[model samples]
Target chain A: MKTNNGSSRAYSITSILILIILAILFLFPLYWILTGALKTPAAINSAVPQWWPQEFTLRNFEVLFSKRSAPLFEIGSLTGPIIPGAIRWLINTVFMAVLAMLLTCITASLAGYALAKKRFAGRVILFSLIVAAMALPKQVILIPLIKEMSALGLYDNLWAVILPTVGWPFGVFLMKQFAESIPGEMLEAARIDGAGELRTFITVVYPMIKPGVGALAIFTFISSWNDYFLQLIMLTSSSNLTISLGIATMQAENSTDYGLIMAGAALAAVPIIIVFLIFQKYFTKGITMGAVKG
Target chain B: MDKTLSPKLRRQENISGYLFLLPSLVFFLAFVVYPMVMCIWTSFTDANMNSNTADHFIFLDNYIELWKDPVFLKALVNTLIIVFVSVPIVCIFSLWVASVIHKMKEGPLSFFRIVFYLPVVTGSVAVTVVWKWMYNNYYGIFNYVLKSTGVIDKNINWLGDSKFALWCIIIILLTTSVGQPIVLYVSALSNVDHSLVEASQVDGATNTQVFWRICWPQIMPTTLYILVITTINSFQCFALIQLLTSGGPNYATETVMYYIYYTAFKLYRFGYGNAMGVILAIFIAILSAVQFRLAKEK
Candidate 1:
């Protein structure tokens, strides 16, 4: 028994040590991006790689910002002041993520509440359809979606990306899981007291599922921000590009400009990384909950 | 629960339910359902960028041609290789990581989870571009590190070479893929009935025996879920191939999903792209179904 305990203890210690080493290796890419962005051009292209920047400069960012320019804000003829195109891309990305999140939460919570609490005709069929749709690859529909967007005069619009993301069924499915935890009797009480459906949802259902909404909100935001393929296909104009798309186009144009590309990469990655770190608890919950019940 | 509802109450329930679902239903129908139906329908016609008037019915010509097309077949094979190689590696790696971390202190556990997940949250474009620089033959850290470590005597054109390009792409795919499974597995592992494990341990069962006989069966669903999701993700790998190789070094890294995009946007073969999309969907469905069946038997 003593030998067994000792051997197992040694085993765990070795495994944990190995995992820590692996973790550092996993983190190296992000580290390289952050440091590489700040390195001098000569330092960046050096044959002998600098583990850390010998000389840090913001010149890469300066070059990135000056490479292209777009208006700060535009609404029809009322254009706002001009800004660096990178900044414009960042703003566009944040707007797209936020809008997608709000729309997803509002629509999903309402539908999920109904699916969980209300006994509707076609409920099973609708739920099954959602599950099936969720199973299929989302990219398969993009070909027709492109045509549909053009037909609706929304081609090359951020709304094209946001709308499809909102339409995904995962949020509704997650909200339904959260809603199932609400007591049926409480809903019954609300109905008996003459509370209308919307009121009950707003007053009772919304509060109960707030955590789920929070999870879904962050999930959708990060996903929308990083959905490069959709953004790549949907938005063509430089001014309309999201950060990921903008960075990609930049990389393509200046393939060997490692410092410039890394700067753009940092611009694309850092804000989303900050968001993930801040709400990581909820983000983790969202992922596990989606899978566990799914 | 529904047996006690009066007809009038049931009717009211239906109305209220539909009203609540109406908002989400509209978006889902318009964006998801409509596009999906159109994709299938367009696959049967010779649609193109200029087919704004009307696409003529071509029936199974697209699929028939796809079968004959060498590039599509190569892409199909590469996609399958990616899926087969990555899924098992992801599943096993995540399972091991989850098991290790699930027993750790709260701070350390979360740290490991976030570390694994960072690559995923770092938008694929950023990840792919950085990797592109790292694989550069002239000035990449990989070559430097490998040389210093005496692992290789010379530089490798990692992305530009046909032999290594697909594997390099797969490695990145694995990093992004493992994060979700780790989260799922950690939760699933923690949720395994500890009392059962304790009981088995007290019965003089070996640790490996207890894990296989007890925990493995219990977490089979999570494994199955991970399998299906990883398979789908691997099959749909697009952004990496697009930004990295553009399916080159002689189409070594071409995937079905990337080929679909190339055909539709670059080649103007909308019908051909849709046909490939249909086949990819069918492959995913069949794989998912098989996983479900296997899990049930176990």
Candidate 2:
């Protein structure tokens, strides 16, 4: 018994040490991006890699901002003052993510509730189609989606990205998992009081599913923000480009300008990373809930 | 759970249900279902970016050409290699990480989870570009660190060489991929039935035996989930290749996803690209079905 206990303790200590090392390895890239963004060009291009910036400078960011310019906001004939293109890209990304989140939450919660609680016709078939679609690669449908967007005169628009993201079935499936737990008795009691369907959903059901909505909201936001492939395909104009796409195009133009590119990367990554850190609990719950019930 | 409803009650339920579903159905049908159907139909026609005339039906022509195209074949093989290698590694790695940290105090557990997840939230372009710097021919920390540690005497152009390029991509892919699985595994592990574990331990089962016999079976569903998601994620690896290598070094890192992008967007061969997309979808569907079958048998 003594020998067994000793061996188990030894095993745990070694494993914990390995986990710490692995955690650092995982974090190194973000660290590199942040530090590389602040490093001087000489340090960036030196033969000896600097683990930390020896001379911190904002020259990279200045150069990035100076590369191009776009209007801050556009409202038909009225446009906001021109700003650095990187800032414009950042604003475009935030708008895209927020709109996608809102749309997905509203649509998915309603559909998910019906699938879980309402005895609707074609429920099984609709739910099955959703599951099947979720399993297939979303990229497979992009070609047709592009042509369809163009036909609707939405091609090269942020909506082309936002609408497809909203249409993804994962959010609906996740809400259904959450909706399944709503007490049937509560819903029945609401109905007994002669409450209409919308009234009951708004007052009772919405409160119950708020946490699930929170999770889905954050999930949709992060995904739409980092959905580089869709953003790359859908938006082509320099002003319409998301920050990720902007940085990618910049990388293509100046492959070896590590400092400037890293600055752009930092700008693109930091906002989403901050959001992820703040709402990580919901994000984690959203991921596990989607998988566990499926 | 079903209870018999009166005729009026059934009608009321149907109306309410369809009302609730209407908003989502509109978007789903317009964006998802329509695009999917059109994707299949377009794969059989001679569609291109510059063609204004109606696309003529050329059934099976694109599919036949895809099978004969060496670039497509190479991309398919590379994609398979990525999926097969990353899925098992990610599963085992996350399982180990989760089992270790699930026993830790709350503060440390969340810290580890957040640390691992940072890469994923960092955005692919940022992550890929940073990695591009690390794999650079000169001034890359990887070469500097390895050389200082006496691991290698000369600088190795990691991404410029075909032999090492795919492996480097896979390594970066694994880092981004494992975060969610670890979260899932940790939750799954904690939810395992402790009663059974105690019973086995009371009967003098060894640690390994308890894990293999009791804990493993209970978490098989989570394992299967991780496997499928990781496989899909690996197969869709595009931004990394596009940013870092652009499927170069002699197409060593070409993947079906990237090739589809190249064909449709770059070459404007919409029909051919849609054909590849169809094949890719079929491949994923078959693999997912096989996984489900294997899991069910177990």
Candidate 3:
């Protein structure tokens, strides 16, 4: 009995220690980011990190907001000055990502409902094609995609990025799984009660699969927001660039402006962070429920 | 009235379904399907961005030369190293953390879960910038801690050195992105049959034995899913490499995706890049098929 008690105590201690270590590991970088954004360039470059800012000021924000300094778009030369360009890029990114999400969720829910509930011709083939599509990397189509977009006069537009990702096969797959868990009887009953397919979807089905849609929305938003490769290839002008492209270009042009870069980064992180916090309950439930089917 | 119009209405329903899916299908076929066909088509040609006015056929020349291209070969090698090394480390760490959280009750455990998952919500720009600061060669937090602790004699150039660059990137990738897998593992563990665990304990099975014998088998499918997705993700890894290093230190960290971007956009070698892209697609598809087959077999 004493041995059992000792072992239990030991187990508890070990668990606590492990948890602390993991927590620190996970949280420290975030702490660093927050502090780095707040600190001055001199303080940041100091041999010993102030741990806290020596003199906190909104100078970085001021630098970001000042538009009279330079045009953000003209810094393509091998060596030239750059404007902050971060704010405009942020607006473009968020707009595209949100629009993409809305389009994806609507289309995905429809396709998912069809795949999960309806019996149709080429059902097996269509489902197989969607699954196979998940494995097809974006690289394979990128070159031709560029040509096609350019031909359509959509190149260097925000729509180019938004449209390509809106038809995400995995998003459809996830929704299909969630829709499958809904009883077929409910749909049948709705049909019997003179409800059209669209009506049933809007009324009974969408509400039931809100968590799945929410999860998909959260993920799609993040990936689209974080996306660099497509945005990089598509957007030529700095003003048209997404936040990710803006930051990358800024880093490339001015490696010395670490303070401004980190500040821009913090700004970029704020919107998504706010979205996550607001939708966290749904996000957590959605992720857990969505994982099994995923 | 119901009987008279039922068949016609059913046909209308089917039509509406197809109509509803039209936008997505059109986009997919045009952007995804058409481009895929074009990629394969271009691979068989000597099509250059500058020489688009002329047609030069080069059947299998790109593939033949790709095997010999040193940079291409190096990128392939680096990609494999990253996928294999990083995925398993991420899985193990996420599982460990998930199990710890599973043992704890809801209050604090839930808080930690949210905290860990915050990185997933935070945009890549923020994560990259944070790591760029943390992994700084001079006066960055990581080096600062290491030097202060006397762990290292001097600051190290993390994203600059060929020796440590990829590994540094991999570490950052694993640490910040453990959130998704942790969520998966937690859900998987929670859904596991508690009765089986109780039965094992009553039969005098130790926690270690139960975990090895029971939980391991149960979570195998989830693990497999993670493996497949992680492999796909590793292949798709671009932003971090692009942001931090730009495939620098003599292209030591160049993954195929990054290489594809460079070749098509920077080098004006669309044909060659498209061919390489097709090859990458085939590799991923074959691997994904194999993974699904293996998972289904069990």
Candidate 4:
């Protein structure tokens, strides 16, 4: 708050300079992905790192797209028309992340509202369980999850990833935190106005907790999209790969093809980064609010 | 908190609460809770990919065997080293960055937050692949930059050498890890009781004194939350390992989480993997409890 003192001002300038440098260092990988994606094979393979690409081309994207092909999607006995496998993987990733986000928001909001406002038997126990489940190492659940998913025929399916993500309980925990700030009097007034439970939630609670949902939605999308561990285990086939998984698989095969891999990396990262940038305010609020009373 | 549960109210509340909770509970119980329970149960049995015979209960065997297995022991040690090394570094580093930037104008503040967060939003695959290239023996940026600057003579296989492999992974882990803690701490610093800060400043307290004495305690909960998450993340460090080293040249970077995947998937030792999973969960639970206890004391 105090900027008048010369020594303090100098200290602030030094810190800001350091911050700017660190910020650039943090941003370097992303800059690499975009530039590397566009760089020629020669530039990528050179002993000298290209701080910036000398020349850019879409050849990497061309190579990436031409690498493989798959059906866009599949039903029980039906499949969509053939397309670039990378596009299919992008479709799969989007589908998984979107479905997971929608389902988590819907379920977590309902459950979170209940945990926050309702007086019910075993509510404490249930709330406690949700918090504990949030902390449980996914490695624990994932081992049996593989078996359970295979048993339920969800293995190698997008639902295998989506269902577990929906069930993860972090969204519920976050939403409950947001919901707790809603005044009880407001809920009581809505009930007195003859609003049904669902109606009261839709009319009153939803508007207030939208920011929390925004936060959860953005994160759930990013996490599920980047959930390579789950995707690697649950999804095995080439055609069923998520974008990130597809890129990783591509790298494993063409290890030294840095341009192609960087293209794939760019494809995997750009849209989510855009989404994060758009909703970052809500995302920050959700993160801070969720940790406030913890 | 003020609401009282009369019998009539309790019944109505029960119905409505359970109704609201139904959809989430269905998925939670079926996927998360069931798998967790199954993980514990299977850990006590000799389950494998071979399904000719049913899994038989062999109580306490997997836990005992894990202690005797050197690889498992090594993985456990590696996991702990990552957690112990990365958690404090992340917390302190993030706190520093957050404190520095919290006072910045909105434009620059958002820019810093977004920058620090870019690696995370970029997803692990992209980040890992690029880092892999950077650490490559021949054309990697690290080797090129270092050799030119006279840091070392010959090219070092960053991810291949046991000496530098684990630390390299930890450095990448540190970058990804700081994003959230920084975000959390920035918000926490901004939200600190402003009056306390101003009062200390008026009393001629230095910036460092205010940060350490007033601001730090106020942000303790945020710090603790970040601590718990960073610990869990460091514990669950898998994708980077799976993509980068696959536990590498000499099992140098083998973490417990990676080992579990290797045991269950590649080797098909499902029971043993589940046991390791159970142990991992226990370790996390214990550490979180300890963190909460330590935080409570302050």
**RMSD after Cα superposition, model 3:** 4.2
| Deviation from native of the Cα of residue B220 in model 2, angstroms | 0.5
The runs of at least 3 residues in candidate 1 whose Cα sits more than 4 Å from the true structure, single-residue gaps closed, are: none
Pairs with backbone N, CA or C atoms under 3 Å apart (clashes), candidate 2? none
Off by over 4 Å in 3: A1-5, A67-84, A288-294, B1-13, B51-55, B289-298
**Could you give candidate 1's per-residue lDDT for residues B13-55 as a string of tens digits?**
9999999899999999999999999999999999999945689
Write the residue-wise lDDT of candidate 2 on A20-97 in tens digits: 999888888998999999999999999898887889999999999999899998878899999999999999999999
Clashing pairs in 4: none
Q: Against the hidden reference, what TM-scores do the models get?
A: 0.99, 0.99, 0.91, 0.97
Ranking of predictions according to DockQ: 1, 2, 4, 3
Q: Which ten residues in a row have the lowest lDDT in candidate 1 chain A?
A: A285-294
Q: lDDT of model 2 at residue A209?
A: 94
Model 1: per-residue Cα lDDT over A179-249, one tens digit each: 99999998889989999888998888899999999999999999999998899889999999999999999
Decide which is better by lDDT, 2 or 3: 2
C-alpha-based local distance difference test score of model 4 = 0.91
For model 2 the TM-score comes to 0.99
CA-lDDT, candidates in order = 0.94, 0.93, 0.78, 0.91
Per-candidate DockQ vs. reference? 0.90, 0.86, 0.52, 0.79
Q: What is the DockQ of candidate 2?
A: 0.86
- Show where candidate 2 strays beyond 4 Å: B1-3
Worst 10 residues of 2 chain A by lDDT: A285-294
**Ten-residue stretch with the least lDDT total in model 1 chain B:** B47-56
